[model samples]
Target: MELRDISRRVGIAAGVVTVLALAAPYAVLSGGSYASQLADYYASGVVGGAGIALFALLSVVVVASVERGNLDPGTLAGAAVVLGVATTLSAAAWATAIEPSPMFRDNLWLVWHARVVVALSVLIPVAAAAYARELLA
Candidate 1:
């Protein structure tokens, strides 16, 4: 079709590829070694898994925006629902970090925090998946 369209697609693809490539290792490392992973994330030693996950998410959203940019407000509203989940996760992570309760110190709350963060994070990925399906359709 058009050169501009081709170039834009190529650029977006390149960006997605670069992000995944750079971030995948960190995610793997994080999964294998939690302390090292958290240190890396905290010290900015590498891109955090959360950041990469968000990038993957936004990538799919961009795809949807490019393809079915005219989706009804209903779908947009569905997407917005994830924002609350994200906020909750962010808040939990922050609160626990700032003032660790005895519960948090006991590893029980830590597990809960991790579970909530992960579960909350899935909301975006799932939405992004739906967006990708609609876009690719």
Candidate 2:
């Protein structure tokens, strides 16, 4: 297959994986009397939810581009770049703006989970940009 076609398929696969990752259980707290409380505290946050929504939106944009076969490569590239930038900004906000609960200090796993979420969030844009570059080439 041509580079463009290969890149498109890879992009779609990446988008699917990202969507699943966002939906999957990031970290499971267990074996502690405070685990339930920590889980509740984690679930009460909005930044993570916002980050997931933004990531989902970006994924939809990338996936939807495939349906618009008439769109030129340049246009697709531009869309991907723009959405990628927006996703990156959202991830940055999610990573820095979240205020972890004092309880989280005792549970380092939650910290790792947050870092993983931020990493995955950042990766979506990187994948989009890579796809865009390939499309342009």
Candidate 3:
């Protein structure tokens, strides 16, 4: 396959993974009742949950823009990168803000979940940018 095609596939895969990560707790929560609760807690808020959804949506937009071969792929990718960075910063801030709370401090699982979400936020834009580079190349 061409490098651009491969990059596109990888970008799509990354988007899928991000969506799954946002949906299921098995990846971060290790599967249990508490897993759902922690997942809900992190994903329920506007800054936390809405940010994740926006990130995932941007990831898909990057891939779709490339596939459509109409809009400027680089611009879309660049936007994703900017948004991803913003999301990461917000998530980190959110985590720090909540970390001192009794619920966050008491639950190690919540800490792990926050870290995973932040990591995924970092990855989504990276994958998008990589695909854009390959497309431009």
Tell me the alpha-carbon RMSD of every candidate: 11.8, 4.3, 4.3
Per-model tally of clashing residue pairs: 0, 0, 0
Give the candidate order by descending lDDT: 3, 2, 1
TM-score, per-candidate, Cα-based: 0.34, 0.62, 0.65
Off by over 4 Å in 3: 25-40, 43-46, 100-107
Which candidate has the top score in TM-score? 3
lDDT of 2 by residue, 36-130 (tens): 55455435444454455565466656545744887675676667666656655655555565567755687666555545655655655565666
Clashing pairs in 3: none
lDDT of candidates 1 onward, in order: 0.43, 0.57, 0.62
Q: Alpha carbon lDDT of residue 68, candidate 2?
A: 81
Total backbone collisions, model 2: 0
Instruction: Write model 1 residue lDDT over 97-126, tens digit each, in one string.
Output: 433334334344343443344444444434
What lDDT, from 0 to 1, does candidate 1 have? 0.43
Q: What would the per-residue lDDT of candidate 3 be over residues 23-62, giving only the tens digit for each residue? A: 5544544555556555556554447665766666676666
Cα error, candidate 3, residue 134 (Å): 1.7
